[model samples]
Target: MDLLRSLPLGLYLEQPVTWLHRLDPRVKMAWLMSILVTPILASPEWRFFLVLLLLVLTLSARVPLRVWRQQMGWLLLLSGLVLLLTMVMPDGLVVAQQPRLPSPAEISQLTEPFETLPPLPQPTGYQYVIYDRWPITITQRSLELGIRISTLLFTLIYGTNLFLLTTAPEEITAALEDVMAPLRWFKLPVTEIALTVTLALRFIPLVLEEVQNLVRSVQTRAINWKKLGFRGSAQVWLQVVERLLENLLMRAEQIAAAMAVRGFTSPDEHKVEWHRFVLRAWDWFALGLLAVFWWARLVWGGEA
Candidate 1:
């Protein structure tokens, strides 16, 4: 139910902005996109590269190490999932503790009296890729591929964690609106786009908190979460989900009523002053640093 439980995640995301937050939201989002994809493109063993990137951002925002430490559970969960997939993949040549072949001693039990059996030996590493003349499927690569993908997934999740931790939801919403403004020429309802983002930002934390509360309540009633089997856990989850729906409905109604009372008209009802959001001298310096970072990666340094 940890998945169901709203982590105290959003609270961290409301991180106090320093130099990083002052950069235009559009610029930050661009930076994040590059940072996310860069890791995926980076070699599998280049996790250290991502780690360094994370550390630099953390220091830049003056983010707490303790908060990052708290997220270790989620990081482990992701890594464990990767390890499990690697161990149980079906398509790869299967390896086993007990050899399927008959040992020399067991050859005497052969149906034919003169039949002889070759000795069975445990393999250290003899992974032969069995040729499948049928159409090659990418899913066969799912586990190993999944492991690779998980690396990027965790990287982005943590990067996003940093962003959320260091920036306020309102600031993020403003950022989203600023980023989406370019689509206005296409008659895109930029306001609606911004609203979707704000609502998601608001609801993620709300739902996480609600779930944690319910899980704690369930625990108090003597249901042991750890010992529950898959089906048993699923049933408990269903009930929790039902309750969540009810809670969400009530909250939605309250929001609707509240908005009606106040003139909370639209997601982009109020525009942010671009000048106010612009890069200050420090922000300009940070932008220059970011450019240098990209230049080094793209040019002679050749290490992103």
Candidate 2:
């Protein structure tokens, strides 16, 4: 019933800060974008390599087993299921057609018998149908599609999860603001946008807390579901939802009032630096490695 602990999707891990936590958020953001974007139109081998790379990063970082097990285990299982299902499904290669010319029987009857030309020497040993049996058939196209889909699914989810796991909400907003600094030239309110993001990230835990409290309160009331029919249960949940919204609005109001009391009129007037953005030696090293990553991707990751 503890939603916060059970579903730690965007929450940060504060204890036992790993090397991943120490790396500059900007570098991490760049790496995250690379992981997400590099798989497009890439070969299946490259896609699978991306998945393996994520696993290696997680292991090398020494993320707590409890944390990653919960995050990655189900994700891996789901991706594997997708791979299997995709492989078994039809790959749209099968087609039936009528021959334009005569069949072999008719040709033989029409022409004089001649020694069958020796079968043309086989060239490459490539087979379109990878596996065929009674109930299952796998084609090269199907296998490729399966690998593409499953690896993309795993990479998309786990890459973002890893970033959020190590980086704090403030750090995330700061990184985003830094990255978006160039947009300010077009009269964009970059500071305001960053402040909004900061507040939104901070509000996530509050939303979760409100939900947990409401659910706990409902459970403690010991409402008799047997006595109250389905309609009654629905009405009770509706009331809970209404109260949750009211509480959230009140929380927002309180935050605004607190800001007003602190004389925070505008983001430009009062800026709070969350984390000083600096590229340490390790961060520079990471950026260099990222460049190398893209180089290899361009050189060999393209689809045949």
lDDT of 2 by residue, 1-304 (tens): 3788899466688977999999999999999999999999898889989999999998999988988897787999999999999999999966998889767788789757656677887699999999999689999989999998999999999999999999999999999999999999999999899999999988988999999999999999999998999999999999999999999999999999999999999999999997999899999999999999999899999988
Candidate 1 to truth, TM: 0.63
Best by TM-score: 2
Provide the global lDDT of candidate 2 against the true structure.
0.93
- Per-residue accuracy of model 1 over 246-277 as CA lDDT, tens digit each: 99888878878987687777655654443347
Runs in model 1 lying further than 4 Å from the true structure: 1-24, 43-47, 59-61, 72-154, 216-240, 264-275, 300-304
Give candidates' CA RMSD values in order: 9.6, 2.4
Question: For model 2, where is the 10-residue window of minimal lDDT?
Answer: 110-119
Give the backbone clash total of model 2: 0
Superposition error at 68 for model 2 (Å): 0.6
Error of 2 at 71 (Å): 1.3
Candidate 2 regions with alpha-carbon error over 4 angstroms: 93-96, 100-121
